[model samples]
Target: MSGLGDRILGLGLLVLAVAYGWTAQQWPEPFGGAEGVGPETFPTILSVVLVAGSLYLMVKPDPDAQWPLGKTALELLISLVVLVIYAMLLEPLGFVIATTLAVGTLSWRMGARPVRAFLTGLVSAVVVFVLFNYGLDLSLPAGLLEVS
Candidate 1:
């Protein structure tokens, strides 16, 4: 329950950031020239920010940092599991369904009532789905909801 916890967490996050940035760089160039920003741009930027934060956390971690325990630890584990599942399900169940499930579970864990939390997740997911797919003209997989 000290800087050890923060150092460990920061190291783990730094590893993940490096892996993410490396994977992003593996993406092929877009159809048009490499003139415009490509698919890797945003992810690379995020990874860079993550790397910086992780470095800061490792270098000057809070000496009194305490890892979560009991209920809080359980909640964190549940959230992590949900996120992993959401990522796996995204392609098969589609963006809206996957996002709703992940967001709703997280919201409920954060103390929102089940009904309101789920409703909020559904509405937010649908809104983002529409915005990304239609407004931005970037298609999201329909998956099980795909039209024949």
Candidate 2:
């Protein structure tokens, strides 16, 4: 896809960014607030950056860009599917499990050996989970790993 297609994709992303930012703003205000930030801060910033990027892409689309074909196209499709599934399963499977599955599969696809790929995924997932949950005070779902 080139030029017009790029603009179209940009417009779509712009719309999504607007919607996401609006939704982020609609999150209920924290009660008994002592904290300096809320859950929506990161998403709001992300949406704003996406909006800027989308607008830039829309205005300056590459005219000579070529769309991916064959194996490249298949890989892109597979990556998209993995991300969508990761989003869907995040709550039920928990952040660590879902992230491991998604990252491991992607890493494996990129030529990492299966064992090493999954081990990387597992380590990364755990580290990020701990950082976000403890350091940042962001609560990721524990899912099946929840302690009773």
Candidate 3:
């Protein structure tokens, strides 16, 4: 991409980061404060980091870096399709199945080997499921499998 394009993308991302931070700040404190941090603290920190990174990119962009716009658009389209399919099939296919399929498809589209991608996807899905459902005590849809 051109320098101007990089600057534009960076500025856009920075704006989004600021907006996310502002929204997080406006969110009601549903979860009680813990010691010094609240539930919104992590998201706020992430937004700040995003803004800082975008600013850095805008200021000192690498000249040699080539932006593969076409490839990126294809990848984005594939990702969106995977996400939509995952959502639509989540109830019937179950979380594990749907998530595994989505992740595998995305990984393959990104140039991973089929077998390796499948295993990686399965592991990622299971780990995420366990982390959110058990570790964080978040209620996620169990789907048909009822793994939860």
Candidate 2, 4-95: lDDT as tens digits: 87898899999999999999989887777736668788889999999999999899999987789999999999999999999999999898
lDDT of 1: 0.88
Model 2 spans > 4 angstroms off: none
**Model 1 stretches with alpha carbons more than 4 Å out:** none
Tens-digit per-residue lDDT, 13-83, candidate 1: 99999999999999887676674456687789999999999999999999977778999999999999999
23-64, model 3: which lDDT tens digit per residue? Answer: 888866656543355556767999999999899889987767
| lDDT (0 to 1) per candidate | 0.88, 0.91, 0.81
Q: Please give the distance, in angstroms, between residue 127's alpha carbon in candidate 2 and its true position after superposition.
A: 1.4
Predict model 3's lDDT versus the native. Answer: 0.81
How should the candidates be ordered by lDDT, best one leading?
2, 1, 3
Residue 127: error of model 1 in Å?
2.3
Report the error of model 1 at residue 20, Å: 0.6
Most accurate candidate by TM-score: 2
Candidates' TM-scores? 0.88, 0.92, 0.65
Give the winner by lDDT: 2
Q: Model 1, 69: alpha-carbon shift in Å? A: 0.8
